[model samples]
Target: MGRRLLLGMLFLLSVKIMAQEKDSRLCLGLNYGFGSEFNNTDYTFINHFYKLQLYYKLSETKHFQYEILIQPEINFAKHQLLNFYFVKPETPDYQQKREDYTQLKEVREYVLNLGFLVRKPIGKSCSVYVLGSIGPMINDTETERMSKGFAFADVLALGFSFKMKKIHFDIRPEIRHVSNAGLSGKNGGYNTRNIEFGVSYSL
Candidate 1:
């Protein structure tokens, strides 16, 4: 009877240790990316994107060895223009009105997102993941020609994570879409594809 009791206690202790090793609570990350041009724009523009993220681990399943997380992120993009524009009114002598012209300049965009991440371990310390998010996005340029404030945003990403002692390194390719649906009629939607690299700390 004493031998049986000793074995039961040892089993419980080992389970506890395994649980502790698998526990992950929080993580912080930063990433940088280069994206394609904004769609539906009158002027030619290029983009460079950067991001910062925070993640909270919600649950883990040992049977499948997968974890679910909630992630909140902020993204910034710098838009460089290849041309300049200006609006000109119709001339008195001509019946037709003049169209707006294009100019070269830099514009910045900001976005805030909340999303879910599903991470599955591939090896002892490496994992592959996918995520989806929705948020609001705005741009420094308030003109109708550019994306206005309060645009609806959505994102999808696929990435791999390499875990160290207390840190995680990640590389992801992502796509972002901003829609003006039900928001504005003047501006259409835009989409971008980018590859990003990030480092995160586990807490």
Candidate 2:
């Protein structure tokens, strides 16, 4: 009876170790981003993002891993516009339009990104990944380039992740497009190139 109880305890310990190994697949990440180089004329956009990321494993391969990324974030932007081409020459409010488009504006956006990532391990502690994401955004201010209210942000990124113990550090460079998809008449949007840094902890 003593020997049987000892065996049962060892089996339970082994099961707990396996559960720990499997539970480490989930992670939480905090990311920050910076962007510049607007695509439209007379427009300067300074962009920043604070992201809370929840990572879920989608599937796995022998040499690659696939993950689902969901991010809820806040975007703060500073905008400067010095040109006015949206209004025509004969329009009644042409001068007023020009005046409105020539000032400094602060815009805030609420964003949610649903993403898919595929990664390949380079060695024991390093990996490379490609991520594609698109989601909705709520624009809190209006501009000559685009309307306020509803839009979408699409992103594509390539990055590397370095794991140190239970924490991961990531460096990513990405391109982004923010547009209304013809949902509004004033749908000329903003385009930017960005770089992001992140730190994550495994569950």
Tell me the tens digit of each residue's lDDT in model 2 across 49-160. 9999888877888999999999998999987775677656775777887787677889998999999999999988999999999999999888877889999999999999
Error of 2 at 184 (Å): 2.2
Q: Assess each prediction's global lDDT (C-alpha) against the native.
A: 0.64, 0.88
Tens digit per residue, CA lDDT, model 1, 131-161: 8888777655543244456676687999898
Q: Estimate each model's TM-score.
A: 0.68, 0.89
Runs of candidate 2 exceeding 4 Å displacement: 1-18, 38-40, 90-92
**lDDT (0-100) at residue 101 of candidate 2?**
69
- In candidate 2, list every pair of residues with a backbone clash: none
Count the clashes in each prediction. 8, 0
Q: Alpha-carbon error at 189 in model 1, in Å?
A: 2.1
By lDDT, who's the top model here?
2
